[model samples]
Target chain A: MQERVNPDKANLIAGATGDWEVVIGIEIHAQVTSKAKLFSGASTEFGGEPNSHVSLVDAAMPGMLPVINEECVAQAVRTGLGLKAKINLHSVFDRKNYFYPDLPQGYQISQYKHPIVGEGDVILDFKDGSTVTVGIERLHLEQDAGKSLHDQHPEHSFVDLNRSGVALMEIVSKPDLRSSEQAKAFISKLRTILRYLGTCDGNMEQGSMRADINVSVRKPRDDLGTRCEIKNMNSIRFIGQAIDYEARRQIDVIEDGGTIRQETRLFDTRTGETRAMRTKEEAHDYRYFPDPDLLPLEFTQDYVDALDADLPELPDAKKKRFVEDYELSAYDAGVLIASRAASDYFETVATGRDPKLASNWVTGDLFGALNKLGKEIGESPVSAESLGELVDLISDKTISGRIAKDVFDIMLETGEAPAKIVEKRGLKQVTDTGAIEKIVDEIIAANPDQVEQVKTKPKTLGWFVGQVMKATQGKANPQAVNDILREKLEVGEE
Target chain B: MKVDEATVRHIARLARIKVTDEEAKNLETELSAILTWVEQLGEVDTRNVAPLTSVVQMSMKKREDQVSDGDCADDIIANAPEVADHFFVVPKVVE
Candidate 1:
C-alpha cells in the first residue's frame, strides 16, 4: 500500500487564515431490483396507485408478521460481491425506531451492528488518466419508507404506502474523497457497477438511487473536523454544487471564530445553498435491539461461491482485458467500459477487425454525432455492424479515409450500410494505377511552375497530390496518387 | 435499576404518553422495584450460553420473489380516520 497524503492541499479552499482541505463521504441508498418488497409479498413496482401495493405485513396489521424475500437477500449479496466487499455469513436485523407520517410502523427494520457486507473498495477513474480507490465501510439492507404528498390537500397530507417496506441497500463509504469531482466519479462508477450486476437500475431521476453527502474542512495534517450531512441528493450535479457550497460555508464559520455544529442539512436546488434542517442538540437514542421476529441470516460458503461464479464480467475486469487483448490506451478503455451498452457495442465492432481504427471511429465519430443529436449509444441510428463495415471499407482501400467520412455521414442520414452507401453514391476510391496516373499526368501538365519547383524542392510534390485528389473528387487513393505523382514528375531520384 | 422522576418523564415522552404528576410519582417506584427484581438474573453465571435470538429454534423463513398479495386499497384504508384517492390522509407534515 502506498502512503498517501490525507489532506491533499491541491483540493484546499482559500480560508481567511490559510487553506483547508475538504473531506467527503457518501452513503448511497440503492433500491434492490426485486419484484416484491423486502419483508412482504407486495409488489415493488414504482408509480402504483396509492396504498394499492401495501400488504398486511407492510401496514403493521395485527397478527401479521414479515417474511423475508429471498431475492432481496440474493441481490444484496450480489451487490457486495460486485463492490469486492466481504460478505458476512452471519448478519442480523434490528429495529430503528423513528416517528414520521410516512412510516406506518413506528420502527424500521435495518441492520445496526452487523451488516450484510463488510469492507470493500471501488476504483474511481478520472479523466486525467488517474485512478483512486475509495474504501467502502459497509452495506446494509433496510426498508424504504412510504411517500407523503403535502401538496395534494390543503390541511392534510396524503400517505402512499407503495414504497413502504421496499428493500434498499445502503452502501456507505469512508471519508476517502477529497474533492467533489472525486465524489461524483465515485458515485458514477458505483452506479455503473450496480447496473452491470443488474442489482439496481441506478436511475436517479425515478429515485432508484439517492446519496447523502458528508462534507468537512480541516487544516493540513490536523485532526478531522466536524462534518455535516446533506441529505437525499438524487442528481450528480446537485451533489457537486452542494459539496462546494457546504465546504465554503464551513470554512467561513471557522474563520469567523465559530465552532462548526454537527447537523443535518438540505440542499436547496433553486438557490444553490445548504441550510440546516436539524441540529444534533437533541440526540437520538434509537435503542436498537435485535429484532425478535426474525432469525439470524446464515448461509454457507458454498452459497457465496455460487453467486461469485455467477457474476458477469465486471467493468474492471473488462477494462483490463480491453487493454491487454485489444492493445487500447487506458483512457479509451475507460470510456468504452464506463457503460455496459457502449462496451458491448464496441466489442461487436472491434471483433476480428482493426481494433484501434474501430476504437477511433466509435469514440470519435459515433460519440460526437451522438452528442450532437442528444442520443444515447443504445439509441444510435448507426448500428455497430454498419460502423464495422465502414472500417472495412477504409482498411481494404475501397474508399479513401476521407471518402469514408462522407459514407459515414450518408450512413447516419440514411441508416444504410456503408457498402451500400459507397456503391449507391459512387464514392469508391480510384486505386487503379492507370486511372490515378492519368489524373497525375493532368495535374503535372497543368501546374508547370509547381512541377519545376517540385524537382528541386521535392516537398512541393504534396501540392500536385492535392490537385490530383481534388480532380478525382477526393475518391483517389492518397497513397497511389503520391506514388504516381512522384514517378510522373521525375522527382523520385531526388 | 432505580428509576428516577426525570427518567420516568423522559420515557413517557418518548412513548408519547400523557402522565399526571401523581401517576409519575407512583410509577417511578413501581418501575424501580420491577427492575430490581429483574436484575437478579445477572446473578446467574451462565457465561458460555449464547444469546437468544428467538423463542422458537428455527431458521429464517423466506418467500419467493413473486407478487402474491396486495391490490385491496379499500381494505387497507378502511380503518383510517380519513381517506382521499385511496391514500390515508393525516395532518400536514412538511418534513
Candidate 2:
C-alpha cells in the first residue's frame, strides 16, 4: 500500500467560476447506552409505551430535582478517552433556554463553556491509503428532548416523554473536513470507535446517533465563509447528498452576488434538497446559564485513568496489529476489523493457523456467505475452530483448496466440523503419488493427440492435467498430477 | 442596562407569554430597573475570586444506573392539561 496522503489535496469541487472548497464540521449527538436516564431513575428503553419510562425528574414536575446518573457520566468519559481527548476534571451543565413542545422543562440541560471532553483527534482513513486527522472541538453531555408527534391529532401534537432526559454526548468536530467524502469517513470512524468503546450503539436509524453538519464553501486559500447548519441528519448517504447540495447552493448564491445566510436548515430526503427552517422572527438566543439545581460535575484523575485502562483496543490499533501480525493487506485488515465480533472471530480462527489464509477465508468466503445469509459474524454457523481446521486441512495437504471450498459450504449448511465432513464424505485429496501417477498415465494414454500438441505449445499441458483431475473426480493432488504429466509428455525438457 | 420595548416584547415572546403594548411599556421600565440593580455586583473589585459554583459546598450527588423508578404513566399524565394514550397533548407545533 502507498503512504497516506493529505485529504485536502484530493477534495476540491470544480465550480463554474473556479474550484471551490467545502468546509465541513459535524456535531454528532450519540445517545449514551445506559440502563437509566441521565438524571432520573427511568428506563432508557428505545420503544416503550408513551410516557411509560418517564420519571418525576424527566417530566419536570414541581420541585423535582435532578440527580446525576453515575453510569452516564462514566460513559461520556469513556467515549472521550476512546477519542483520545482531554477529559475535563471539572465540567458544568447549563440550561439552554428555548421553547419547544418536545422539551418538558422549556430548556435543555447541556454544557456550554466547560464540556466534559476537550480537544481530541479522529483519524479518517480513506480507501486510497490516505488519511486525514479531523480535530474534535469538544464533547459534552446533554439531555435529549422527547418525541413530538404532530400527525397524531389534527388540533394538538402528542408528546411522549419516554426519550426525555436521556443522556446524549455531543461530539463536535473542528472545521477540518473539506469534502463530503471526508465527512462520511469521519462519521464512520467516530461511530466505530464509539461502538468499540461500548459507549454508544451508533445506530443512526434508531435515532441513537445523529449529526448536525455545518457546511460552507470558499475559494482556495481564502478566508472562511459563512456557514449554514444542517440539523438532524441520520443517514450517512443523506449526509453526503446534503453537504453536496448545500455547498453547491452556497456557491451559487455567492456567484449570484448574494451573501450566504447562516441559518439552520433541514435535509429533505425525498427531494434531496436542503431548505432553511422557519426560524423565529428573531435569531435564536439560547440564553445559556449554569443549571441552578445541579452542581458542577467534578471527578479525580484516578477515575479517568481507571476508565481508560478498561477500554478495549480501538479500531485503528486493531487494524494496525492485524497488518503487522497477520501480514494482511490494509484493505483486508480494515474489513476484518470493521466490527468487534468479526475481529474476534478472525483472531480466534487465526490463533494457531496460517494467518493470511485465515484472513482470506474470513474476509472473502465467510463474509460473502454471511452477507448472503443475512447473518452477522456473531451468528455465523461455522465456528472459528472449524474454519481454522478447514484451513489447516488445506495447509497440511489433506484436501485441495477446491475440495476445501465444498467442505466449507457443507460446514455452513450442516454446522459440522471440516475434518469430520472430509472424513465422512471421503473427500480427502489423492496425495498418494502412486495413485495419481496411475491416473495421469491413463489420461495421457487416451490423449496422445493433445500430448503431441503440448510439445509444440507447452501451455496445453493444462489440458492433460485437467483430464487427469476429471478422471480422478477432482480429488487428485493437482501439483502431483501436473508433475506426472510433464514427466510423461516430456513437456518440461524444453 | 436599558430594557427597551422591543427587548421586553422579545423576552415575552421567548417565554411564550402574551403581553399588551402597555404591559411591555411598563415592563421596559421595571425590567431595566431590575437589570440596573443586578448590575451593581459588577462594580465590586473582587476580580480574583472564582465564580460561586454552588451555594452548598458539597459535591454533586450521583445515583447508580438502574431502573428504580418509572412505569408510572398514569401518574405522569395526571397533572397534564390534556392527556391521551398516556401522552401529554399540546397545541400543534409543526416546525
Candidate 3:
C-alpha cells in the first residue's frame, strides 16, 4: 500500500520547491563540418561575401536540381558514429514546406519519417562531479536557411544566401534534463565531444552550433503538460537563462489560474525574456513529404564502421584518461579537456614534466593571461615548450616562484621563451646561501630594534624577510632567506 | 485530427495569416483531412522505430585553422535593400 511516486517527479521536487517538473529537451543544430553545402557545391564557409558562395541550386534558380555532396554524407555518417547512434542504411529527405523570405526554395529538405541516426545518449558531468546521461532522440541532416537582415531597412528586408544550403545536423535530445544547470552542462559536454570528434566546431558566436530549447512545467505525478520551444538561442548562457526564465514563467502562469500555451517563442537577449513568436506548428502544417528531387540516402555498415574507427578520442574517454593517467583533479581535468586546444596545450607541457603543475599553469596562470589578452589557448603567445621550460626552471631552483612571474610576463609580451626572458632580464634566483645571508644580515643590522622584537615576537621576523627580499629585487631565494632568518632570530630558543 | 473553425482561426492568427472567415472554415476541413492522414503514421508500430531527424548522416565540416575571411564592404552592401556607399541604409527613426 505504499504511495506510488513518480521517479521523475521526485527528482524534480528535490531540485526545486514545487510540485512542478521541468521537462527539458534540446534540439541542437550543428553546422556540418564540410567544405561544401549538402545539396550544392557552394562553399560552406562562414562570414563569406554575402551570396558569393551560393551555387545555382542554392539560389533556387530555375531547373536547378541539387546534387548531393558526397563529403557531406560522409560527415553525417561520421557524426552518427560519434554519437553512438544507429545509422540507418536507407534514409529519405523530405520537403519541410514553409513560407519565409529567407527560404528561397519555399521548402527545406529535411528528414521526416526515416532519419539517418537513431536514439543515443550523452553523458554530462556537472560541477558537483555527478554524472547524468541525457538521451539523444535523434540526429538528422537539413539545409540551413539564408539569413534575413531585418535591420537593413525599415520598409524592406534583405536576404543573405551565404548560409543557405549549408548542411546542418539537428541533434534532438529526450526530455531527460530537469534543470538549467544540467542543460548547460549537457550542452558544454556535447560541444566538447563534437569538437573532439572533428564533427562540429561548436562555435556559438559564429552560428555554427545553436540550440532550440523545449521547456514544459508539469505538476508532480501528473501527465506531461504543454511545452514551449525557445528558438535560436545562440549562446549557452542564454540557453540556461531562457530555460530558467521560461520554466518559472510557465509555473507562475499555471499557479495564477492561467494555462500554458504551446508555442514557438523567441528569446530576446536585449530584454532577457521570451516572447511568443508563433503557435507550435504540427507535422501536417509543414506538409512534409518525400523530397522528389533527391534520392534515398543509403550507406553501408563498412562506411559507418570506418568513420567510427577514425573518431578521435571523445571527451568522456579523454577526460577519464586525464584523471587516471595524468592524475589531474576532476575540476582541473574538466577545465583542461573542455576545449581541444586547452587539452593539447596541457599535454605538450605535461609530456614529461609534472602533470599537476602543468595543469595549474594551463588552467590558472596561462588561462588568466589568455583571457586578459582576449586570446584562445590556440592563440596563446607563450609556446607550450616555453611554458614547460619555465616550470622546469622553478623545479630546478634556477628561478624562484616570485621571479618566474616577471619572466612569464616578459615571455607573454615578447613571445620569447621563459628561459631566454629570464636570461635577458637577469631574473635568475640568487639561491647562493652566502649572497642571501649578506642581504639578510644587512637588513637585520639596519633594523636592530625590529630584530630585537623578533626574539620575543617570532612573527615580527617576517617583516625583516620582506625587506630583505625587496632589497634583493625579489631575486633572493625566498626559502633561503626564510631559513637563514629563522636560524638567526631563533638563536637563543635553539 | 478534426480541426474546428475556431481552431483554424486561431492557427491562422498564430501563423500570421490574414484569413477571412470563409477561408478559415475551408482551411479547417482541409487541415482536418491532412491531420487524419498524418494520424495514420501514429498507428504504425513506431515505438521501436526511431524518429528520423535528418536525411543524411554527417558531422560538421571543418576548414583549415586560418582566418580566411576579410571584410568586403562592397560585396556585403551589394544586396542591401537600401545602401549608402559601403554601408547599409536604414530609415532614420530618431532625430
Candidate 4:
C-alpha cells in the first residue's frame, strides 16, 4: 500500500564502537511434496492422528531397511533445477549421528560431504528496482525427525512419528544476504520458485518450510566475525525481526567488551529477543558416514534433460515476459507472477484486452475481492474468461468505464458472465449519436443561463457534460458527451 | 583417530550411554588398538580411485509413492516401551 521506509542500503548496525556490518546466510528446510515418506511408505499428510501415518522404518524397528521413494528424489532434483543449481548425478546419503527419542533412528540419514546440488545464485529483486545475486552454497536431501509434544500431558510428553522420515531438501546459502529485506525477499522468491515447480509446497504454517539464519557482524571491509545461528524461524516477518534483534544484540555484546559466543539461539517471538538454546561447547559432533543401506544416487543427463523440458515457466521468466510481451511495469509483473495461479489467471484476462486495464483489474479489483472474501484466485466465483469479456466490453467502448464497473460488481456477486450482466441490466454505453445529441439539446434548452456562462467560463462545459451523463444513468460514452456538449451548445466557438 | 581420555568420556555421553571410569580406561586401550589397525589404510597410494561408499553397485530401488501402510496406532504403540494415549511417552523434551 505504501513505499517501504528505508531504501536499499548496506546492512550496517551503527554502534558506539563502530558501524557494524551484518552478514546473513540462511539454511532453509523445504519438505518435498510426496505422498510417502523419504525412506518409508508412510504418508506425509500434516495434522494426522499421532503415529497413524508412521511406518515401521520410520519407527526404526528391528531389521527394518529403507526403500527410497522415487517421487521424493525427483522432487529434490526438480527443486535444485528451480534454484538454478547444479545437480550432482552421484551423491551419497550419510548417517548424521545423534540420539533423541523423537529421532527414532539413532542417526539421521543425510548428506554431508557430497550433496545433491552444487553452487548456484538467486537474483533478489528489491523494491527500489535494484537487484543482488545471492549465492546458494549447496542443497542436500535429508530425513525429518519426529515431533515431540510437551503440552498434552503435564506428567509425560508424547512423540509423533508422522513427521519422521519425511524428506526435506536442506538448502544452504552462502553469507551473501546483507539486509533483512533482502533475506525476506530471497525466501519469498525461492518459495515462489518452489511452488512453481510443483516440487515443494512452501507452507511454513504447517512446518513444511522453515529457515535457520546464521548472523554475524563485522566492521565494513573487515573479515566476517564469529556468527551465531537463530533456529527455526517459520515466518518471513519473524525471520526479519530475528535478524534485526540478533544483529543488535551482538553489536551490544561486542561494544560492552564481551565476546559473542558461537552458539545456536532460539528467537522468542513474544519477547522479541533471542536466548541461547545451546552453546558451541555443548554442540554434538555428528560423526557422519555413508548409510550402509542406500546406494549412491546416480542418473544420466537424459533424465535431467527430461525434467528440464517439463519445467514450468518460472517466476523470473514469467515476470520478464509479462514486462516485455504485455508491456507491464516491473512491480505489476512481479505481483502477477508471484503465484502461478494468479499469473495464469492474469494471462487469461489479458489476452485480447488492453494489458494495462487487465493489470489494473487483476491487481486492484480482483485481488481486493479475493482478499475480502477470503478466497483463493482459483476459487474465484467469476472465471477468468468472464473477467476478460468484461475487459473487452470496456476496451471497445460498448459499455462506459463507469457502467463496466457496475457490470463487474454484479458479475462478481452472481458469478454471471459480464456481457450477460451488461445485456440484462441495459448498461451498455449510449454512444448512439442520435440519442446522445437529443439529450444534449434538451439539457442546453433547459439551462440557457448556465450555457451563457459556459462561453466565458469554458470549465462550465464539465457541468453540461455531467448532466448529460447523469441523464443517461452514467452509460453515456464520456468522450461522445464532451463533443456533443461543446458542439450543440456552441460554447467553445466564442 | 585419536582416542584421548577425555574423548572417551565424551563419546559415551554423546551416545547417551553410561560408562564407568574403570571401563573407559580399559575401553580406551582397545579402541586405540582398533584405530591403529585402521590407520594402516593411510599407506595406500592409489589417488585416482573414487571413495567407495556402498559395496553394492546398484542404484537405489524406489517404490511407488503411496500410503499403503499406517493408520494402526495400536500396533505402533504396542512396540513402544511406555505408551500413554496412543503416543510414545518420554521424559519431557524442552525446545
Candidate 5:
C-alpha cells in the first residue's frame, strides 16, 4: 500500500510536556462461519425470531450433551493459516464462569490456557507507504452468549437465545499498535484477510465481529501505564474516535494529579466520550476449568497442511503483486485490494487494458459513483467488461476522455455496453484530420475580427476551438483542432 | 488462598445471592478446610510436567456449514418461567 499523503503527525498523542505515545492492543471477537451452533444443532443465522433458533442444549437443559461442531474448528484453522500462524494440533475448551441474565448456562465455553491458533503476525500497510506488523497472540474458539433486549418491553426485559451458543473466534493481538490510526488500519487489514480466507464475514454491524481496544498512554521510554479497555466498539470510525478520546482522557487525569484506574469502559458514540461501566474494582476471577463434557481438540499435521494448501491470496501478497505486475502505485493497489470481490473485479478490468487508465477509473470514478449510491462494486450497474471496454475506447482514441464520462453515466443508468452506447449516441471521436481541419478553417474564416486578437489574447483562442467542436457535435479531435487553429492564426502574428 | 467470613460474605454479594451472617461464618470454616486439604498437591515438584487441560483426548468434531435447525420456538422456550410473544420475559431491569 502507498503511504498516507499526510502521515507526518501520525499516531502521536500530544500532551502537556511532549507527545505521549499511546500503546494499543485489540481483541476481536469474530463469529466463525458455521451452519449450526458450536455445541447444538441450531441455526446461526441473523435476524431470526428471538427464540426460533435456540435448542435445548443452548438453553442449558439438563443431560444435554454438548456436541462440538467440526466446521467451526476448521474455519478457525483456516483463519490461523491465513495469518501465517501456528495451528496447535492439541487444544482445550474450558468453562468461563460468569453470571448474566442472557447467559442461560451461567458460564461461557471458551478456550482459556490452551488456544487453537498461536502467535501469528499481520503486516498492515498505511496509506502513506509505511507498514507495521502487528502480532496475533492467539485465536481461540468460544461460544457467544444470548442477547438481552431491554428495549423490548417497557417494564420487563426479554431474552433472545438466537445468538447463544454461536461459535466465536476471539483473536487477540499484541500491543504493537502505536496510535489510533494504526489500530484502525490493523483492523481493516485483518478484516480483509479474514474475508479472503472465508472464515468470518467480519460484519461489524450485525455484531458478527467486535473489538475491545486496550489503550494506555506513556511518555518516551517509560513503563506501561494503567490501561483501560473500551469494549464492544463496532464501527471503524468509532474505534479511532474512542481511542483518541480515551488516550486524551488518561493524559488529562494524570496531569490533574489524578491516578488512572485500570477498568473496562464503554465508548458513548452519541456524546463522543468514554464512560466507565459499573463493575468491581478488582478483576473477577473467571475460575476456568476444563469442560468435562468435551474432549481435547486435536488434529493432524496433514489437516493443517491441507488447509494451508487451500489458502487464498491474502491482501498484502495480492497488493504486492498488483504493484509489481500492474505497475500501479501502492495507494491504488491498496484501494483495489480492500475487499476480495473488489480485487477480483479490478483484475478483470485491468487485464489487456491500459493498467494506469484502468486503475484511475476503477479507483476514482467507479468507486466514487458507488459511494454516492451506497452500493458495493458487486452490486454495480456497470459490469467490469463494460467499464474495461470504456477504458479501451479512450485508449484507442475512439472517444476522447471527456466523452467517456458521458458514456459511463449512460451505462450506469441504462446498463448499456460502452461500445453500443457510443455507437447509438454517435459519441465516437472524429480522428480524421481532414474533417477536423475543414471545421477549423470555417471557424477562422467566420471570426476574422477575433483572429487578430488571438496573438495578444492567446487564452481566447479556446473559444474558437470550442466553436469548432460544437459544429462537429463534439466528435472532432481536440488536438487536431488546436493544431490547425494555432497554425492558421500564426500566419500574421510573426 | 484462605477463605474467611468476610471473604465469604463478599463472594455471596458478588454472586448476587442472599447469605446470612451465621451461614457465612459456618461456610468459611468448611471452605478453608477444603482449600487446605487441596493445597497438598502444590508440594509436589513437577516442574517438567506439562499442564493437563483435558482428561479425554480427541479431535474436534465438525458439521457442514448449513443452516438447518431453527423455527422451533415453542419447543425451545418451553421451560421459560414466563413468556410473551414467543419471548422469555423477566422483571424489568433498570440498568
Candidate 6:
C-alpha cells in the first residue's frame, strides 16, 4: 500500500539518480450487468456451455443485422451518471476493422472519438486517510469479443462465443495517477462506486471487469515519455505489482542511457515483471469507420431524465450521509459504505441505535465472521434485526459483552434470533445483585487468604472479580461481578 | 489518411493476417480512398454536435442484486467444432 512519491520526491529522485518519473493511466473494461448482449439477443452469462449463448449475429452469420439492447444502453448511461460524466444524447457505433479467430465478425463494434459519456472524475481514499482525485477521459460502450481457450488443446484452439457481443463499458482515465498504488486505489474505489450504483458487478476475478494499464516514465518537468500498454490485468494486486516493476524497468533503462520504446507488454505474474507483447498500435491502424448497417443512436431528453430519476444514492452521497447523519468517522464511513448490501445492513442496524457501536460490530465482528466463512455480507446468516437485538441486549445489560459474542456465534450457526438463542442456552447475564453476591461469597470463602491480599493490594481486586466471573460462567455482568467481589473482599466500604 | 506499404503491413500483422507485399500495396490504395471519405467528417462542424457513443441514451437497468445459475450449457456448446459431454474438446494441451 505504499504510494508512489509525490511530484516533489519524483523531482528529487530524478535529479539524484538521473532517472525519470512514471506517468500512468488506466482503461477499465467493466461488463454491464445485463441479461443480454449489447447488439444481439444472446445471453450475457459467464462460464456457460462454451458457445450456447451465441446468437446468429454474435456468430457473425451472413445477412444478420445487429439490434441494440436497450438495457445495455441504460446501463451505460447509469455508469456515466455514477461517474458524474456528461451523458451524450446522441452516440454512434463505429466498426473497428480487425481480424482474429476470436472475433468472428472480423471487426469489433465500438465507439470511437465520440463516446457516450465524457470528462469525469473519481476521488479515491487510501487506507492511510489520504485522498486523490483521478480524472476520467471518457466512458464508452462497446461489444466484447469471444474468448479463446488456448489451453484446451496442444494442436488446436477453441473459441467460446458465449461472451461475444456482451456489453462492455470502457472507462478511460487520464494520466493523473503517478504511481501504481494510486492507480489501484482508483480502480478499487471505482469498483465500489459501480457496485453501489448497480451499474456493474465489478467482479474482476470472474472476468466481469479488467484493466489496461498505460505506463511511461519521464524526467521531472520534461515532456511526456514513451509509454507501454499492459494488457488485461484482472486483479488489483497484480496491477500494482505490474506497474511498480514496469516503472522500475523503465527507470533503469533510461538511467543506462537507453531510450524507452513504446510497445505493448504482458505482465508475467510468476516472475513479477513485464515482457514485450507487441508494438502499440495507433487508431489509424484499426481502420475505424462508422458501421453503415447500424444507424446512429439518438434519445430524447425525457428518456435521460427518466434514468436520472431512477438513480440510487451513489457512493459519495451515501458516504457523506454516513459521516454527517450517523456521526461516523471518515474511515468507518468509507468501510461501511464500501458495498451497497453492507451499507444497507448497517443502516438497518443503526436505525434508532448507537451508530458508533453498530458500525463497530458490523465492520468488525460481522466482517471477521464473514471472512472466516468466505461469505459476503449479503450471504451472512445473521440478520440485521437479530444483530441489532444482540447489540441492544448488551446495551441494556441483559448479557455481558463476552456472552453476547457466544450468543452471536450460536445465532450464526442456527439462524436463530439473538434473544431466542440467549434464552435457549441460559446465557443471560447475572445482573441481579443477589445472584452475583452468591457467586462472590463462594469465591471469597474458598480463597480467604487471597481475598485478604486483594484487600491490601487494591489492584489485586481484579483477580477476585475474575474468580467471581469464572464461578458464574462468564454470564455474570462484569460491573456487577466487580462490585460484589469488592464488597465481599471488603476492598470497598459498604 | 494515406496508408503506406509499411502501414499496411503493420496493420495486417496486428490483425494477425498474412498479406503478401503485393497485397499490402493494393490495400494501401484502397484504405487511403476509404480514409479520404471518412476524413470528410472534419468539415461538418461537429463542435456543438455531441459525439454519439451508443444508439440509445437510457440509463442502466438494474436487477435485484442476486446471483442465479446461468444454466445454458447445451445451447452454449452447440457451436463447438468438437465437444465431449458439456465441455468443448480439443487435442491434449499438455504432455
Under the 3 Å rule for N, CA and C atoms, how many clashes does model 6 have? 14
lDDT of 2 by residue, A175-221 (tens): 98889988998898898899899999999999999999999888877
Q: Write down the TM-score for model 4.
A: 0.93
lDDT of each: 0.90, 0.91, 0.80, 0.88, 0.87, 0.82
| DockQ top scorer | 2
lDDT of 2: 0.91
lDDT of 3 by residue, A151-187 (tens): 6667655566778888899999888887888889888
lDDT by residue for model 4 (A1-494), tens = 11122223466678998687788899999999999999988899999888999988888888999988888888888888888999999898999998788998899999999998898878877667888888888999999989998898787779989999999999998888777888899999989999999988999998899999999987776777899999999999999999999999999999999998888999999999889894545356899999988888888878888888889999999999999999999999999999999999999999978899999999998999899999999999888999999999998888988887788789889999988888888888988989999998899889989989988898888898889888999988998888878787676633
List of clashing residue pairs for candidate 4: none
Best candidate according to lDDT: 2
* Residue A203 lDDT, candidate 4, scale 0-100: 96
Which one wins on TM-score? 2
* Model 2 docking tier (incorrect/acceptable/medium/high): high
Grade the docking of candidate 5.
medium
Candidate 3 segments whose C-alpha is farther than 4 A from its true place? A1-19, A278-284, A491-494, B1-95
Off by over 4 Å in 2: A1-7
Off by over 4 Å in 4: A1-13, A278-280, A437-467, A486-494
In the order shown, the candidates' Cα RMSDs to the true structure are: 2.8, 2.8, 6.5, 3.8, 3.3, 5.4
lDDT of 4 at A457: 93
User: What DockQ results do all the predictions give, each relative to the true complex?
Assistant: 0.77, 0.86, 0.08, 0.73, 0.60, 0.17
Model 5 compared with the native: what TM-score? 0.94
- 10 residues in a row with least lDDT, candidate 4 chain A: A1-10
1 against 3, candidate with superior lDDT: 1
Q: How does the DockQ of candidate 3 come out?
A: 0.08
Share of true Cα-Cα contacts across chains kept by each model: 0.82, 0.91, 0.00, 0.79, 0.70, 0.13
